[model samples]
Target: MKAVTIRTFGGPEGLAVIDVPVPAPAAGQVLIRNEAIGVGGVDAVIRRGTLAMYGFEEGHIPGSEVAGTVTAVGDGVDASWVGRRVWAFTGVGGGYVEHAIAAVEEVFPLPADLSAVDAVTLGSSGMVAHFGLAHAHFAPGESVLVRGAGGSLGIMTVQLAAHGGAGAVAVTTSSAERGDRLRKLGATHVLDRSGQGGGADAPAGYDVIIDIIAGADMPSFFAKLNPNGRMVAVGAVGGRPPADFGMAMMAAFQKSMSFATFSAATVSEPDRRAVRTAQFDAASRGELRTVVHELLPLEQAALAHRKMDAGEVFGRIVLTP
Candidate 1:
């Protein structure tokens, strides 16, 4: 077996491919021959050793998701799982390889029409976007905004909000080309990445704000939300933004709006699976889509990480093994 390992933590170059013995599945786990892998901004963060504050050690793999065929199942696992095409969340690492192990419970059987590339890229993004928006709900005909709506998560948020009955969908992005795509994806208005409504016509303003870039522009966005509205911060792709408690509280007071942050870990296992299933079905029907920038080979995993970290990636980047 071959796997990309991070023997040292510093930059993307640290991701080196090496030969290793095929790992056998432990009890309640399954071994998969990976067909594709999912790469996102968080992978870069981990690569840069940001998570080391909590003790992330070196020699760990960097992939979080993989789509492949199960070659073997461990004790207490169903033998029928063998040879099933599926995608599994290989939590925290251990996915940048030809074959990886995943807990049996994490594996999801794929639909016949779904390709491994699509499952690991767009399919995973849809599930994440669904889970992120689960933090707050907007009523039908309500105004909605997807802040920093240029990345994979942002793209999904914009599409789902529009398809789910948002009367007005607004988005913010740095790329003009991406802005145009967002409009086509269901956005009624597209604002510049730093713009806070400005001359744009907003109907009662944004009733719900799905923010991925909670940088210095946050306070300005907070001011745009309608009274009693909610703003959910789901990402910080623009590096860590300094949060001044007093300033945020003042903004909240001005509009009587609520603010929260969501993570997949906050949701129960059953709820997560339900959301993943619904989003996957929606994607298969062509209702939800991912803006895949490229599908590179597993050997170029480091290059994918570089692009993602540089903000050059617009959507999901899949790596095939």
Candidate 2:
């Protein structure tokens, strides 16, 4: 089997594809003949050694989600699972190869109509977006704003909130071209984010704000929330927000506004499963669309990482082995 590994993590150049032995499924696990791999922002963070506590090694595979067919099942797994097409959360960072292993509890069978590309693309980002909408305290007919709306999670947030009955959906993107696409996806308003400084006025007073860019944009975004409105900061892609981020909240004290951050990384198993199931159901019904920016071969993991790090990928990047 071939897998992508990062021994000395720093840049995309260090993401190396190498031959490795196929891993066998242990108890409660299934072996997948992986057809597609989901590349996400967290994968990039792990690759950069920013979260070095994860203890990635020379042969550490760097993917988390995969869509594939089950070739075999380990002890305690149902024999009927073999040959079933499914999308799963790999136990470790081992989803980057031709074959992957996942715990049975982490696997979800995919409908025949779902392509592996779509399945992988809908993995983690979709889950986060689904849950973040709740953290926004979303309500039907309310105005919503999705910051960093060009990214995978942000894009889904825009779609879900739009479809969930938001009266007006707004999005912030780096280009007018990107904003135009977002408008087609359901955004009623598109704000050009390129060269737009933090705290820039962006048509204020949204009822719910989904912020994935929590750096310089925090203050302005925090101040724009309507009275009793909620802002959910899901990512810090631009960089960490300033330490005194509460200043905006203090100023908005009269509004009774609230700000919270969510990460699927810290979610419990049951909660993760519930959100993923809801996302899959929405995808199956065509209510939620999974967008794929690019599909590359497994060996091009480095290129995928580079594009992701540069914020050039508009949607999820799938890797085929």
Candidate 3:
């Protein structure tokens, strides 16, 4: 079996393509022959060593999202899934290989109409978006503001919020190109963070704010929420441990709003199953569209990591084995 493994924590160059024996499934696990793999920003963070202290043992495979066919089923597992097409969240690793093993419970059958490319990209990002939107408790006619609306998760957030009956959906992107994409993805209003006029004169209140980039802009995002509104923090791509929270509290107090952060690991099993089912249903109906920015072979995984780290691509990038 061929796989990309990080022998050392450094850059994309650190990921070496090597031939290794195919892994056999353990008890209650299934071995899959991977067809497609999702490349995420966190993979880049791990490669760049920003997240190195988290302690991923050497020779680790960095992908969490995978879509493939089960080739072997382990003890105590149903054999019916052997030929089934599935997509799964492997948590932190084991998706960047020709053959990978996953616990049977973590796998979900993919819709017949959806392709491997789309299903692989849905991975954690789509699930997280579904979780965040549900947490926002969006009611009919409520409004939402999504920061980083150009990224893969941001695009899903925009579509889900609009589909859930949001009265107004506002999205912010630092790239002008992404502004156009966000509007097409159901954003009622698009703000370009790079321009002074984009978000500067925008409305000051929204019922919900889904912030993916939560660093220097925390204060500004807090100010945009309406009284009693909820803000769900999903990512800190810009930076972490944001400066003073006094101003945010004052703003929140004025509006009686609440702020919360989500880690995918904290989501319950039932919720995870619900999210996967809902997302696949949406995909089958053509309601959920995955924007694939690039697709590369498994050997080119390092290049994919570079592109994601440079922030030059939008939507999801998938790797085929």
Candidate 4:
């Protein structure tokens, strides 16, 4: 089996492609013949040593999302799933390989109409978006502001919120060119993070604010919330945390607002299952679309990482093995 492994944490150059023995599924596990893999921001963070303490040891594989076919089922698992197509979140790292092993519980049957590339791209990002929106208790006709709206998860957030009958606002630093793409994805309003209209005026205070980019603008975002508004934060791509928590707190108190953070580790099994079910249901109904920005060969994984690190990607990047 071929896989990408990093012996030292650094840049994309640190990721080395090599041949390794195919892993056999142990008890409660299943071995998948990977057809597609998803490259994510967290993988870049791990590669750069920013998230090194998260239990990813040296010589570790770095992919978390995969869409493949089950080639082998371990003890206690049904043999009927042997030839079934599946998508999974391998909590640790192993999805980059030709064949990866995962616990049976982590895998879900893929929809027949969805391709492996799309299924892989929807793995972690789509699930997190679903979880965050659900935690916010989103209601129809509510208003939502999604920061980092040009990214993969952000795009999913916009589409899902709109599909649920919420007014969606997308915020991104990308030029008008990319903002148009977000608008087409269902954003009622597109705010350029680099312009004056970005945070200058709070248009019709948002009922839910999904903050994927938590940086200097967080206080402003909090202030824009209506009474009883909820803010669900999932990612921090701005390279730093908010430096003005006092202001944020004051705004929250005045507006009777609530803030919640999402950690994939803290998501319960039931919640995870619900997300998977919702994603597939939506996809089958054409309410959900996995916008793939690029498709790279598995060997070009390093290039995919570089694109993500530079923040040049508009949507999920999938790797074909």
Which residue pairs in candidate 4 collide?
A: none
What's the TM-score of every candidate structure? Answer: 0.93, 0.91, 0.92, 0.91
| Rank ordering of all candidates by lDDT, starting from the highest | 2, 3, 4, 1
* TM value for model 4: 0.91
The lDDT of each candidate is 0.80, 0.83, 0.82, 0.81
Mark the regions of model 4 whose C-alpha exceeds 4 Å error after superposition: 194-204, 215-217, 240-247
lDDT of 3: 0.82
Locate the minimum summed-lDDT window of 10 residues in model 2. Answer: 194-203
- lDDT for 119 in candidate 4 is 83
- Candidate 2 segments whose C-alpha is farther than 4 A from its true place: 53-59, 194-203, 265-271
Higher-ranked by lDDT: 1 or 3? 3
263: Cα error in model 1, Å: 0.8
lDDT of 2 by residue, 26-88 (tens): 999999999999997777767777666756555467898999999999999999999899999
Mind giving the per-residue lDDT tens digits that candidate 1 earns over 1-321? 778888789888888988999999999999999998988767777777877886777888888889999999999999999999998989888889999899987888887877888788765567667766667777778888888887888888888888788888888877677778888988888788775442446554678898887766677777777888888888766555565733775746867888888777777778767777776676677767756789999899889888877778877888998
Whole-model lDDT, candidate 4?
0.81
> Which stretches of candidate 1 lie above 4 Å from their native place?
196-199
Top candidate by TM-score: 1
